[model samples]
Structures are given as C-alpha cells and as structure tokens.
Target: MDPTAVGRSGAVILRPMRVDDVAEAERLSALAFAVLEGNSDLTRPPERAAAWQVRTAHLVSRDGAGCWVADADGTMVGFATSLRREGLWILATYAVHPSWQARGIGRALLDAAAHHGRGALRRMVGATTDPKALRRYRSAGLDLHPTMVLEGTVGATAMELPLHVRDGRPSDHEWMDSLDRGLRGAGRGEDHTLLSALHPLRVIDRPHRRGYAYLAPDSTVELLAASDRRTATDLLTDALSGAVGADVRQAHVTAANQWAIDVGMAAGLSLRAQGYLCLAGMKPPSPYLHHRALL
Candidate 1:
C-alpha cells in the first residue's frame, strides 16, 4: 500500500481516527481555539481537559467512521468528528492545529468526515468567525446564517420565569428526545446523558407546551429545543434566574432564532454577530439555541 494514501509526504497522513486519538485531539483542539480567539497568547486550565476527552470519546464511540485525524509522524495535528441521526448530519467538532491551517488538511478532513452524511438530507454545524472555515462550509453547499450572541448582566427584570417551566428530571429524557426529533430532525439519545451531566437540563412540559434548555451554573443556555417560539423564549428566560447582575452570556444565536434575540435584548442584554450556523437542506430551527460542540 502507498504510504501517503491520504495526503502530502509520507510523514503526514489522513486516516480514520482511533478512539485513543481523543486525548491528542482534545489538546490540539484547545490549542487551536485558543490561537483563533487569542487576546495575545494561549493557555489552558489543565483540569478541563478530562471533560472534553469524555465528550470526544462519545462522538468516536457513536460514529467512528464519521471521525478522522490528520497525523504527521505520530502526532495528531487535525481532526473532524461528525454524527448522522434521523436524517440529520451534525458536525460535532472540526479543528486543525493552528500551524497547519491553510495547508489543505482541513479540506481533506472535512471531505472525509462529510462522507458519513452522504445519504442524510440535512446537515448542520456551528461555525466560528474564521474566514477559511466559513469558506469551506460555503463550498460544501451549506447556506450560511450569521450567528448572534446576547450577552451581559441579566437585569433583575429578565430573571422572571413563567409558572409552566420547571426543573427537568431524569424522566424528561424521552420527552426532550421527542422535541429534538420535531425541531432538529433527530433525537439526541445518549447525547442527552452527556449534555445533562455537563449542564443541568431545565424543562417545560404541558398540553400544547413542551421544551428543554441546558443551563450552566453561570446561566448561559448551553442548548435549547422546543415545540414553539414562545416555549423556547420562556426556557431561555428561565436560564437567567440566577445570573442577575453577573456578567452573563448566551451564544450560538442565529437569524433562525430571532425570538431568543428578542427576549435577550428585552432583558437589557446586548446582541452582536459572531460566527455562523451553516445548514444544508434545512432552515434554522426556531426557538432553538445550539451547543457549539454538540450541535
């Protein structure tokens, strides 16, 4: 077999990512993002590494074929992990070492990972502000909707949540999965276990009303899915009950989720355009907020 069956020189290769690659992939991913979002340099908290490893491991376990890694010698320099569910294909994570950017490695990994979505009718990914990544998604045939973020101190005013919304329990998993199917064209399934563990899930379930939101301790909406725009707004509003006067943030807002933007701004939070929500064969799901890695 040819050594460079994947690309470049024999020293560099693109191949199926192994489960063991998750550790290296997580490190490289963090370093790359730090560089991308640099205020001047890069740093890591050290303790947060294990959490990402668990998340990355789940992706590999569920869809190994949808994950790929770029290896130069024995080191993992780039990787992409994706998953296909109920006719929807989601790009979970895509990153390349900052030094390897613009070298065609990202394009290769994207093409490889996207193959897993071949028969899926819809595709989605939360993209960053990086120009090259945006171009790659555009070239792949996804329509781009600029992403917005609503962030600031939650005025004491916005913390009021309606009566129907309540703390989600373990029993709510099935219902949340149902909402996932209705809104995003798929069910999160086991992914829910991971998400709920990371951020406690908040829910609203009633006749004619059903929705879910994962709220971090800091009050950011990690993810939200709902039956209607109003339900979606309520769930988001509820996420901020404990964030009053603190510097809070809600991210991953797209034009598809204007209700969130409206509710957020009405609470005195500022809105700004950041990355994008790229889609193919679908429109942005309304009253929905997305998790960067999971969505």
Candidate 2:
C-alpha cells in the first residue's frame, strides 16, 4: 500500500490499519527514509524502516491499539501511530506518502491521532529538526516552545567534565528521581513522557552490557560522568551506548544545564541541528522540558 494514496474522496477511505498492510507499509517506509541525504551517517534507512514496521505492526495487532491509515483503492497512502498512556495518547509517527503530498493527507493523519486522544484535555507531540515538518506542525495548531537544544555536525567542546561511572538500572527509580530533580533544577518543565524517562530497561550491546554507556527503556540517558570540563563527553558515550537496537543516523542533544553541554562536548557529539519546542496550547509555566525529550 502506498502511504501517499490515502484519503481519496468517495472511493477512498481513511481508517484503522490491519494485519495485511505490513509489507506495503514497510515498502513505503523504505522509500520514504531513503530520501535522507546523510543515510550513511550512522544507521541506514532499511534498518529504521524495519524497526518502524515492527512497531506499527505491533500496534495494528493489539487490541485497543490505535493506528489510522489513509487508504485509496486498498492502498495505504498515509498513516499515523500512537500509544495510549495514563488515559492520554502520545503520537509516535504521522506520515503521508511522498507521492501523496499537498493533499491534506498529513493533516488527516494528525487529525486521526488527535481523535484517538478524545476526552483528554491535552496532547503532546515531538517533532524533529526537519524544517518542513516544523512548519506543518505550527500550522496544525502546535506552538513552538523554546528549549535548550544542542546539535551540529560541527565538533566543539561545550564544557569539560571528569567523572565516570557504570550505567544505572531502570529499576533504580530512586536515583532516577534524584537525577530528575537535578535536571529540573537545571530548568526543565514537568512534561514526563515514557520517552523522556526511557532509562534502566534498555540493554547495551548485543553480546554484553558494555556496548552502551547509558541504557534505558524509553529515551533518557542519565549521565555516567559529570564534571566542570568533560561532562558532555561522558553523556555522549552514555547515549551512543544506549542507542543500540535503534537506527540513529545522527545524535541531537537538548539540555538546560551546564552538565548537558559539557558532556555533549566530551563525547564528541556535534552541534549540527536545531529546532523549536512545540507546545499544544497557550504558554503554561517556566522551565519546560528540553526539545529532544519533549514527547
């Protein structure tokens, strides 16, 4: 099924996905991800497509799992995926086939995602640094919230640190809680999604646990090193180590604290990309979560 052919008027249809759509979805995914200019920077497009297809297939396979697809003549043109959490839904991905562009297909996908969160007062979305998507998100009633972001292929040291330690377990909620507090002190709001707190459960390296510096379930990588001079490097090592089993062509870091920048530098993670924090509603409070973990 083509992700671009979704949402035709009378003959076309947009509805939840089904089991049979996996192969076409994977195909569309490969075609889509293949457009990246830096496909070889880290992970390749096929790997990401496979992983996304697995996740989407899982969503379509489960009961109460919500995934909306725009189908035209039995072809999947566009699709949106979400996960329900604490009675609210978090959008995972919303995409329309490249061939189906400028036809409101993306909007249809977003609307479907919003529809999945019915009765919930608020919804959260995370967008990457893709400028085109950023514009579309803003037009879709998403507000660009400021955040502490660090990205660049350009290499530079933000700060230096001098502490090293092994990764902490996900079950170590106490330490995580403390780290959260420290992060909050550095100016982060209370937008804690599972992705933000993705730590502990993630295993590092297929052969052993030493492959990743920080391992967590969702996305957060608690620092393994902290110092005035080399904190950024330690954090980068932790993040790269933690990114196993996932396709990451590049790394984007967002942090409000000195430690975040410092560790990023030490790890040699570049400051290559930039983006705005997208908020769903009017301004709320100070110290909002950084952009990288907004979801």
Predictions in order: lDDT = 0.84, 0.47
lDDT value, candidate 1, whole model:
0.84
Clashing pairs in 1: none
Q: Which tens-of-lDDT digit does each residue in 72-170 have in candidate 2?
A: 887887776765533334565666676775666766676665666665444455665556667777776777653344433323333233244344453
- Tens digits of per-residue lDDT, candidate 1, 186-231, equal 8888888888777778889989889999886578788999899989
Question: What TM-score, computed on C-alpha atoms, does each candidate reach?
Answer: 0.93, 0.60
Residue 186 lDDT, candidate 1, scale 0-100: 85
Worst 10 residues of 1 by lDDT: 1-10
Residue 286: error of model 2 in Å?
11
